[model samples]
Each structure stands twice: as C-alpha cells, then as structure tokens.
Target chain A: MDAIETNSLGRRFGDVNAVESLDLTVQKGEIYGFLGPNGAGKSTTINMLLGFTPPSSGSGTVLGYDLEHESVAIRQSVGVLPEDFGVYGRLTARKHVRFAIETKGADDDPDDLLGRVELADVADRTAGGFSTGMKQRLALAMALAGNPDLLILDEPSSGLDPNGAREMRAIIREENERGTTVFFSSHVMEQVEAICDRVGIMRDGRLIAEDAIDSLKDRFDADSRLVFTLDTVADDIVPALETMNGVTDINADGNDVSVVVADASRKAPVIEAVGASGVTIKDIRIDDSSLEDLFATLTTGERPTSRHAEENAANTTQLIREADQ
Target chain B: MSWVHVARKDFADALRSKLLWVLSALMILVVAGISAIPQLLYIPGQGPAPGFDDGMSFMFTWMTMMVSIIGLVVGYRAIVGERESGSIRFLLGLPNSRRDVVVGKVLGRATVVAVPTVIGFLVGAVVILALYDGFAVTDYIGLLVFALVIGLVYVSVAVAVSASVNTRAKAVGGVLGIYLIFDLLWWTVPMAIYWLLERELPGSTDLPAWYVLVERLGIWEPLGILSGTLVDIAGVETVSTADRLAGDVPFFLETWFAWVIVIAWVAIPLGIGYYRFNRAVMS
Candidate 1:
C-alpha cells in the first residue's frame, strides 16, 4: 500500500479553503518532498494527514489505516516532526525523547536517539535553553523514536544552519535507506531536490505537480536555451537558425546570438549550422533548469531569471491558473 | 495506561518550575503554623488553655482555602500553557488521544496540590502532637484526606477550563470567573433566591430544604458538609444539618449525598472539558 493516500481531501476555515480537494499519494520507502510556498496549504495538508486537523471533505489513509478514524493506530507506527512545535520548556532533551518513546510504547533509549540527532551532549539540559537549531534536532530525535515505519516531517530543516540542514538530510536519507517512508515538507527547493525520490508541489491548496526530480527537469528541458557569442552574426543566419528543427527563436545583438530550442537535442545541430555558415563562435553557454527554477515556475507562476525558464513559466502559469479555477 | 506516562511527564516538568516547592512551603506554614497558633496565644493564667480541638479548628479553616487556590494555580495552565507555547503539537502528534491529555493533566495537577498538602500535614502532625493535648490520629488523617479531595475538585475545574479554551487568557478568565462565582459569591445565590421567594434574606436556622439545597450547589457547600463528617472535630463547623433546615434533613442534604456532589464537581467539569477538547482542531 502507499504510505499515504488522500482522495479529494480538503479543509476550509470559514470562507477560505486553506487546502482543497487534494489528492496525494506517497509510495512506501520513498523520500517524498512536499513543497510549497507559505500559505500554499503545505502545512495544512500535513496537518490533515497526521490527524492534527480534520478534513472538511473526502477521505484518506496512512499506512493502510483510516486517516480520520484510525489516527491513533497510524501514529503508533509513524513518527512526526510537526511544524511550529515548541519543546517543553521544563523538560530535558532526554525527557522529550523519552516522552515520545513512552507514548509510542517503544523501548528505544532516549540517549541513543538523542545521539543520532547530535543532541546527546545536552541530553540532560532543558530544551528551552537550546538554540533554534538544537531545538530542531531535539524535535527530530523525538520524531525518530520507536524507529517508526513512516516519518512525516514538516519543514525539518526550518531553523537549522547549512551544516545542520545537511545533517538532517543525511539522517533522512539514512532513515529512507532503512525502508522507512519519509514525507517531509519545505518551501526550500534545494533541500528537497538533493534527497527526494519524488516530490509533490502544492500551490493555493492544490497539488499542482508530482513527479521525480529528473522527470520534472526533463519536462522542463523542452525550453532549453543555447547562447553563442560570435565574431560576426550574419543577417541570414538569424533567419536560418530560427527555421531549423526545434528552434523556436533566434535573437542577435552585437555579434551575440541566443537560440531558444524546443529540446536539448536541437542545441548541437543549431551550433553546427552556425559553424557551417562560417560564423566564428567566441563563447558558448548552455542554461539547464534546476528544480529551484521549476518550483518558481510552478508555485508563483513567475518567470525564472535563467535564460530559458521564461516560456515554461508562462505555460505553467497558464496551466496552474486554469487548474486553480 | 498512557495517561500514566503523561502524568509522570507533566509532574516532572512542573517540578522544575519550583511552584511545587513554593506551594509546599505555603501549605506547611498554613497547616503547621496555624495549628500552633492556639498554643502560642494561650497563657498559664487563662481560664482554660486552648486544646487540640482549638488548634485543629483554627488550621482547618485556612487549609481548605489554601488547597483551592493551589489547585487552581497549578491546573489553570496545565493544558492551555502547552497550547500557548506551541508544545501541544508534540503532545497530540504522538499516539495520545485527547482524553489522555485532559485526564492526565487533572491527575498531574492534582498531585502538585497533593504533595505539598501531604508534607504540610505530616509536619503539622508533629507540631500539633507536640504543642497540644489529645491529638486524634483519624481526625488528623481525615483532615488530610479532605484537603486532597478539595484540591482534586478545583484542579478538575481549572483543567476543564484549560482544555475548553485555546488561549491562556481565556483559560485564566475562565478559571478566575469560575472561582469567583462559585467559591466566593455562591453563598449569595441562595440568599438572593430566598429574598425573591420569601421577600426577605435567609435566616441562620429553620430555613426551607430547598433554600439550603440551593446553597449546597455552591462549590464548597457539599465539601463543607463533608468536612463535618470527614473530620468530625467538635469545634469545626459543628452545626448539625437538622438544626438549620425547617424539618428533617432531605436525602440530598444528607452528608452521604454530599460525597456524590463533591465527586460530581470533579467528574462533570472534566466531562464537559473533554467534550470540547476532543472536537478541537489543533491548527
């Protein structure tokens, strides 16, 4: 069974539907990145999955247990790093982890869990005294208690430094390697792109896109741009390049030529055609879109400043607005 | 039970606040300090020196009031504070049911009141035994048990208020309003009803059964009835039920029935709190 499956699950707070008709599926033993901008219903969706908030429409299941009715059973085997959670000011790091272990009825040593999160040094110290990064790790240790079959982390690296975020990614990877399904949410695209096996992007309470990173990049690659600085740009070469297969546009200014190709395969032929036309190429740079660009294109419907993401951004913006309506 | 873990965690966490120790000191001063007052004030030439009964009655008056305040202070923040600090996300994110949180908080805060009470009584026993003659062990134990029950009652009320609201301000208002209306001003309820029904205030004795029954609904009324039977000290609220009522005491006014009311004080608020709490969205 999928680790998590929601069908048309939605939630509304009065007139605003914070999350609406979300159909999400995350496979078992996969690291799924739940990405969205703030107020995009990423947190709301996570809240619904963990039974922190009841959905106003449809149904869902986690670990094959009913999301609404069997939340306790689901939580018994699922570990969570909830968003905006505060540590008990009076409880020690060890106590926090111990509390989670005891509630899960798991016999894991609190110190051992704390050690994994790099919190063993301050295990006896009250968590209230810890810095934001330490508190994040402490929360992670508590979430890692019982060696849960599924991990639902809401912005696990939220308060961490780069080093801490890298460590968190490593731990998440380790957990996923142990056959645990890891579902984590973040507004940062880099963190998710680094480790996620699959990702689902939410925008305005809707799942706009879900796929593997490579596939998303491949789909986004349709608008690749190849820029060439030439010794001289022939007037005919501009029209010539535009007429080539997969060449959508060609602009020339002061010996600098830019070619927007419909696919990556068209890049080489366009350059060869220019060379064959006797234009001496001075410099060559190819712009490949990253997941960060993809995220920008998907969520805000805004253009990525990178060379070729503009056309894809316009299309995605049109697609998303239509999907939203 | 899962609640056991929650209670243990809650108690351990509250211990760090030092509120528990402060309460113990206050309780010790009230229980032991007040019990010694009758002896301290006595003189050799006085017509009859103050006895054990004198000291017991002196301290009993203050003990119930202290326990009520301590219960409210400890419990009013038990659940609501977690919400205010965003820590409840950790609480409900685990496998615990909302029932576990409410029930565990009541028991946990009840103990915050109970521990100091036990310490105060233990110390008071030694002081009362040394300073006064004829120390009644069962009577002393009865006072201790009575204090515990009173503490539990208020803690249940405060925790109920905590569970029923999301913000600490609302919890504070709720507990304060409950204490003020029920504990302090409840006596006026029956008096006003008597004034409206009979066109005069209620007299001290020979009143209607319904008049006195309305007074019993006050937070401390049933407990007051209980203190008579629970402690059985001659000097402490010694007025019998029949003397105040116009006729024989009704079954509801009977001391045994007071136990039912006191228990309802504990169970009813928690029931209502749990009903609201279970349906709350953590968002």
Candidate 2:
C-alpha cells in the first residue's frame, strides 16, 4: 500500500482555496520530497493528512486508515515532525520523547532516541532554554519514537545549520533504510534533490509536476553544461565538434571550451571525440540543471509572481532544438 | 487511558516550573497563617476566648475564597498556553485525541490545586490544635474536603473557558467574567431580580423559592448551601436555608440535594468543554 494517498483532497480557508483538488501519493519505503514555494499549499496538505485540519472536499488515507474517521489510528502509526512545533520549555528533552513513547504505547528507550538526535548530554536540560537547532533535534527525537512505519516531517531541516541539516538528512536516510516510508516537505531544493527518490511539486494549491529528480530535469529539456579546460586549442576545434552527436551547443574561448550535451550518456562520446581531435583535455566539470532552475521553470511565478521567465526558458530550449534540426 | 500520560506530563512540567511550590506557600498562608487571626483577636478576658470553633469559622471562609481563585489561576492557561506556545503540536501530533487533552488538563490542574490544599490543611491542623481548645477533628476534615471540591469546581470552569476560546486573553476574560457574575456578585443576581419582580430587594426571611433557586445555579451558591451539610462549625452560617424560606422547602432545595448541584457544577462545565474542544479545528 502507498504510505499516504489523497484523492481529490482540498481545503479552503474563507474565500481562498488553500489546497485545491490535490491528488498526492507517496509509496512505501521511498523518500518523497514535497516541494512548493511559500503559501503553495504544501503545509496545508500535510495538515489535512494528519487531521490537524479537516479537508473541504475529497478523501484520503494514511497507512490504510481513513483520514477523517480514523485519524487517531493514523497518528498512532505515523510519526510527525510538525512545522512551527514548540517544545515544553519546562520539561527536559528526555521527558518530551518519553511522553511521546508513552502516548504511543511504544517501548523505545528515551535515552536511545535522544542519542539518535545527538541530544544525549542535554537530555536533562529543559527544552524551554534550548537553542533553535537543539529544539529541532529534540522534536526529531520525539518523532523517532515507536519505530513508526511512516514518518511525516514538515521542513525537517528548517532551523538547523548546514551540518545539522546534513545530520538530519542522514537520520532520515537511515530511517528509510529501516523500511520506513518517509514523506517530508521542504522549500529548500538542494536538500530535496540530494536525498529524495521522487518529488511532487505544488503550485497555487495544485500539483504541477511529480517525477524522479533526473526525469524532472530531463522533462525541462535541461542540457548538461560540461566545462572542459584544454592544454592546447586546435585551430578547427569548434567546427570539428559542431557536427558531433548530442552536442546541443558549444562555446569556444581560448583554451577553455564548454559543451552543452543533450543527455548524460552523450558526455562519454563527446569526450572521446574531443580527445581524437588532437586537443589535450586538461579537466572536465559537468553542471546539471539545479532544482532551483527547474523550480523557476516549473513555477515561474515563484519570483515577482509572474510567468514570463517560464516562457523565456522554454523558448530558449526550442531555439536550440530548431537549430539542431 | 492515554490521557494519563498527558496528565502526568502536564503535572511534571508545571511542577518543575515552581508553580506548585508557590501555590503550596499561598495555601499555607491562607489555611495556617489566617487561622491564627482568631486567636490573636482573643483578649483573654473578653468574649468566648476564641477556641477551635473560632479558628475553624475564621479560616474556612478564607480557604474557600483562596481555593476558588487559585483553581482559576492554575487552570486558565492550561490549554491556551500550549496552543499559544505551539506545544500543542506535540500534544495532538501524538495519538492523543482532543478529549484526552481537555480531560488530562483538568485532572492535571486539579492535582496542582489539590496537592497544596492538602498540604495547607495538614499544616493548619497542627496550628488549630495547639492554639485552640475545642478541636473537633471531623469538622476540620469536613472543611478540608469542602475546599478541595471547590477547587475542582473552579478548575473545571476555567478549563472549560480555556477550551471554548482560542486566545489567552479570551480565556482570562472568560474566567474573570464567570468569577465576577456567577460567583462574587451572585448574591446581587437574585436580589436584583427580586427587586425587578417584587418591587423590593430580597429580604433574609420568608423569601421566594425561585430567587434561592437562581442563586443555587451559581458556582459558589450551591457550595455555600452545601457547606451546611458538610460542617456545622458553631459560629459559621448558623442560619439554615429552611429557616429563611417562605413555606415548606422544596425537596431539591434540601441540604442533601445540594450535592446534586455540586456534581452538576463539575460535570456540566466539563461536558461542554469536551464538546467544544473535540470539534476545534487545530490550525
């Protein structure tokens, strides 16, 4: 069964449709990255799934339990690290996790959970005086209680430094390896791109794109920009490489040449042909299209709330394709 | 049963905040410290040399008042504070139902008020025994139970208010309004009504039964009425309800039925609170 499934799920706040006809599915044992710009309804969807907010329309299930009728059971099985969650300031960190374990009727040791989040030493310290990063870790430790089958984390790395965020990612990966289905929401593209097996992008309360990262990149017609430094430049280098396979575009300037290839598989052929052309290849640096750029393409209204950038990027790719023809 | 965990956690957290200690101190002052005032008033040669009855009558009045206020203070922030600080995410994020939250908070806050109350009465017993002569142990225990029941009543009302509203400001206003209208000024409610209908203020003798019944609906009125049943301290509220009635008293107005009113005071508010809380859409 899918870890989480929502069909035609929607929520409306007053006149605004906060989440409109959202059909989201996260398969078991996969890290599904929920991506959206701010106010894009990602959090709203999470709230509905967790029964924090009732949906205006449609139905859903988490781990075979109905979202509306069986919410308590859903929560019993799913571990949630909610966004904007606050800790009990007067209670110690270990107390927080132990409370969760008790509430869920789980047998996990509180100290072990604290150790996982690197909060073992501070377990006796009150959460009220903890730093933001420490509070986030404590919340994560609580979420790790009970060895839940599915973990729903909203912006899990939001308050952490880069190193802390990396630690969080490692823990999430470790949990997933333990046969746990991880569904986490984030606006940060790099972390999602690095860790998620598949991603579903939301925009204006609707799902616009859902695919594996490489496929999503490919769908945008993102050509890989390979920058190579040559020991010596051949006089006819540009003309000779122009007719090669999968070379979308090539720019030559002195001893540095950059080739935009249509796919990753074409990089090997282009490199072999370039070596045969009598130019010594000094270094190769490949830059695939980042998720930030893909998001800028998919949700072009992300900045300044306009759609012009999306059309421009599409037109640039079309121009390159026509030139190849 | 899961509410047990919620209650335990709430008590532990609030206990560590030192609020319980502060409450314990206040209760001691009200019960033990205030009970000694009657002894001080005794001039040694004038009047009945202020014995145990004097201390019991003097201290029970203050104990009731303090318990009511303390209960409200301890409970008003129980649920709303969590919502405001966003700790409710951890609360509801677990398998906890909203019923569990409301029920657990009431029990937890009730214990907060009860622990100190028990301590205060224990300490006050020693002081009352040493300072006075007619030390009736049953009367003192009766008053102690009365104080604890009053604490539960007010805590239920405060937690109900906390559950009904979404903000701390509203919770404060709710409890305050309830205190002033239904509790402190409850005497005026029936008096004003009697004047409006009967063209005069309600007198202490041969009064309308409806006026007394309206008074019984208040938070303190039923408790006050039941105090007669709970204890018979010599100098405290010696005039019984039957003495002031116009005719043969209705069965419901009897001292025993006041137990029904007290139970309603605790039950009805909690029922309403749980209903409102269960339907709340956590944002």
Which parts of model 2 are misplaced by more than 4 Å?
A: A221-288, A300-325
- Candidate 2 residue-wise lDDT, A176-221, digit = tens: 9999999999887877988899998887888877778777656545
CAPRI-style docking class of model 1 based on DockQ: medium
lDDT of 2 by residue, B1-283 (tens): 8899989998998789888999999999999999999898778778768888878888878889999999999999989888888898899889998889989999999999999999999999888888989888888889889888999999999999888878999999999999999998988988998888989877788987887788888889889878877887877775667888898899888878888988898889889888887777777
Per-residue alpha-carbon lDDT of model 1 for B74-173, expressed as tens digits? Answer: 9999998998898989888899888989988899889989999999999999999999989989989988999999999999999999999999999999
- Which 10-residue span in candidate 2 chain A carries the lowest summed lDDT? A303-312
Q: Lowest lDDT 10-mer window, candidate 1 chain A? A: A314-323
Error of 2 at B60 (Å): 1.2
- Which residue pairs collide, candidate 2? A89-A128
lDDT of 1 by residue, A205-240 (tens): 889888787777676766677788888754657977
> For this target, which candidate reaches the highest TM-score against the unseen true structure?
1
What TM-score would each prediction reach against the true structure? 0.93, 0.87
